[model samples]
Target: MKEMTGLVNTKNKNKLPGDGVVGKTCNNVCNNKTFIYTRKSALTLLKTAGILLLVLVLLAAFTACVSRSNQEVGDTGTGTGTESSSGTGRETGGDQGDVQGAGSKDAGEFPLTVTDANGVEVKIEKKPQKIVSLTLSTDEMLLSLVDKGRIAAVSYLSVDPGQSNVAEEVKDLQKTGLEVESLIAMQPDLIIVADWSDQNAIKQLRDAKITVYALKTPSSINQVKDAVMTVAQLVGEKGKGQEIIQWMDGKLKAVEEKVKTLEDNQKLRVLSYNNFFCTHGIGTTFDDITKHAGVINLAAEQGMVMWQEISKEKIVELNPDAIFLPAWSYEGFDAEEFAGSLKNDKSLAGINAIKNNRVFCLPEAHLGTTSQNIVLGVEDMARAVYPGLFE
Candidate 1:
């Protein structure tokens, strides 16, 4: 495990006037008012009345000044005042200043209550300044919805080029495993984890009174969009989350338009396979990708459910029109080499994908993505299946 570092340092420069100060000032004004009202004799009473009026005017003016000063201090402290249309706020510190400002806008009322993927309602008292993401999907979404400085840490997979879309963006951020102690040390205001994260770890964090939001594992494009919106809402960036969804919709719309031109006969039967003979099936994001790309998924058609392993004979029998392999290597298993082996296997020569040379190595970052970047997977499959359509 990498040592936890890069935690954001937030320093509030301006302090609001304390209640004691205001209380003392009010006490002085009231004491003078009482003294003036107690004056005896007609002339003294008239003079005291005039002084009383002046004192009241000064007190009101002083109270208004204090109120305005307190408001300014609050606005400066939260970095939410005078937000620009670009969604940025006053710089707070180094690179984090811009990021802090970006996330401060469009934040709906605090003391927010929402249910998590686990069906547990969690309440947030204020906008979270320090956030930690335990899932790669949430890691990707957070980078887009908030400032990088606001993120205390992300998952270890987020820095892996083969498995993450925002690997480069999160290189400088701290990485964490499921260690409860490390998360506690970060002092995060909120922690985002996948529904599949270890229940024991989550329990421990919750026991420590940390705010942990468990997001459902997105198995389809629509589910992915929902996760994005949920994360944005959790972090007070719903507008940015909507913008990301729109961007995804816009790209998907273009792909759908192009795919509409393909006739039923022209649509290719595609299969995504890994070295372990594991392939995605119905109810998986890959299945959703195939549907949107206008391609027939061989695994779904063969009555497969989630990720399942099949024998080599099944691949031969399915005889997909195009086979999508991952463009990544892990645990000594190389996808490019697997693709080569598939092409050279004489026993599999009868397969259409092999004979037609339609075997492709799609980026695992996109193919396995559960974020807005899943549209890239859709476009990759669509373009690979019908090269001429994209051209």
Candidate 2:
């Protein structure tokens, strides 16, 4: 091969005019013998032809490679790769089928089987025309990712403007409970229930052959983002899931950049207070929100976990740098009066937060959320804790 390649290179050089290679070779051949000149010329022609053939082969191979790449990109539409589903030669697009996210994928066209948070595989033969959401989190997620007309019902809590972020949007939808009877009557094409939902209800729904997927409560921001993607995947709206994730990512990045000036020691100690006189602690979504907002959760530090109730004395002892109260607590009452009462409360009067008037009423929907909208909660808290940074 090496010898042949060298010969091809020599012939190529001889073909170029003014190289003197061909002239020198022809002179040597003519001086030796006239008969040998014809033979040398024939050999030179064969070498030149071989080089041309190799060049054509290389060009053809390159062209073929480029064409294949273009064809793949064109066929897939999304440059991401496709995977073949089991037994079906039909191509099921993976991350490439939809916008990229934690939960976006084309699980194949119809009779799609999706594995839920519980690792249970649920199959859907067609696009769900009617869907029922059993939790406020699912209500908001479904509303954001799916058409309103397809929603057969939402959790009763979703109708209360104070409890749901999409309360206004869900008001027209049927308000229902997770009772087996109600769910059976709705005849939902798909039912979304929480991991904490009643096992009996889930059993009844499954017994009826209704497609029900249980969504796990997201304890962290990443899990929350994944939840959004999961719901989007179940509803066959992976693109919407990606959009939700992107929106959350943008807000999170903005909050992160805005808080760069604040040192770790500068983070404000914060606590979330609810109507039940409890505070959010470790393993709760509120803790995730405070951490993302560049604040330390006081309750979590005090060894509280998962909505633990604290006495008034503990409130003074912890004396968070800032107190976040749900805005819905002001319902049927004056906001100014509510804020003033907390400010003047004898027990909390000595607290630094109350003394400095740093108590803020966070939106009910934003504070209690465990979905993509939790980004809104993080943003609200960040702005409240560090107003100067936002400005």
Candidate 3:
């Protein structure tokens, strides 16, 4: 029966056996003040346990919500967060991995795929942040394209004068040759080599799962632009490469136009020779440059890639109108002074090129590097041969 004044019956005799009860002595806590005291100390323990259980459940629910939020961020690669949870001993559906920052292309973007000049399929992982250059020429090209800080290592000879331009920038990276240990230690995202010549090195790097690419080095001008463009396409900088090519094409067209105006009587005969009096043979890049400059290359009779002694009589007989000698520093040869000596020699006095005072010094920076330097060489040759149109 209900108590008078609408109070709850506090007598344990009226309560269920399983209903563990505790009460404060205060009348406010129970129907009668005389029925209980001291918070019904023993029964209070039961309610304390129940209160703790409720709090733990709420905490677990909150943690699960937080973990789900992090999972959303991980999928989007946006917030790049980590989440941990503990509840009911059975957890599911949490993203696990390191957070990859958004690349220049897009967030979670990776694996730039391409087919190289060699017609082999290639793939790059994780937007290469660090690069190691294997050739001296790649070292020069890297100087113009990416930041110096992005270069991890370069070939030893790249720092020498007349070979590389970014010597000061790559001082530390030149400490060791392109050894696998040294290259891997730099943590480079990619390694660029001239060709497949480093098969052993490539195998070692691939065993360790490092990405490497073989860049092309063309023997002639026709292949030069194509090689440079190939590298640009691989690195997602094709737009920049095409722009440079367009500029080169326009420059070449300008030179060709100038040559078109020259009369047959005005065709200059140019003999392009390497150091130690070695001539650039048939189908050399100099042939294209000289032909564009309205000059005839005298070395067309020789074989491809190199030339043997063509006899002093043949040189005198051809009598090129100008001797276009490349300035190079080799064993005991001062490129500039040597070219001057060749021009002033008593034996060469009768040669048409020597008599006409048409000796030219080509920049060593041009022919020494890679395909990119070939463009520079062509420009230099064009300007040196015909300065009026170039200026």
Error of 3 at 22 (Å): 99
Better of 1 and 2 by TM-score: 1
In the range 111-142, model 1's lDDT, one tens digit per residue, is: 45555667666767777889999888888788
Off by over 4 Å in 3: 1-110, 114-121, 165-176, 301-309, 387-391
Q: What are the per-residue Cα lDDT tens digits for candidate 3 across 140-241?
A: 555444555666777776666544444555666654465888777776778877664467877788677777776656666555565555444344444545
Q: Which is superior by TM-score, 2 or 3?
A: 2
**Cα distance off (Å), candidate 1, residue 283:** 0.7
Query: Model 2 over residues 8-78: C-alpha lDDT tens digits?
Result: 22312211001111111111121210001111222222234457779798668767766766665444423
Top lDDT model: 1
Off by over 4 Å in 1: 1-107
Model 3 worst lDDT window (10 residues): 12-21
Regions more than 4 Å wrong, model 2: 1-105, 330-341
TM-score-sorted candidate list, best first: 1, 2, 3
10 residues in a row with least lDDT, candidate 2:
14-23
Clash pairs, candidate 2, are none
Q: lDDT per prediction? A: 0.69, 0.66, 0.53
Cand. 2 TM to true fold: 0.69
| Pairs with steric clashes in candidate 1 | none
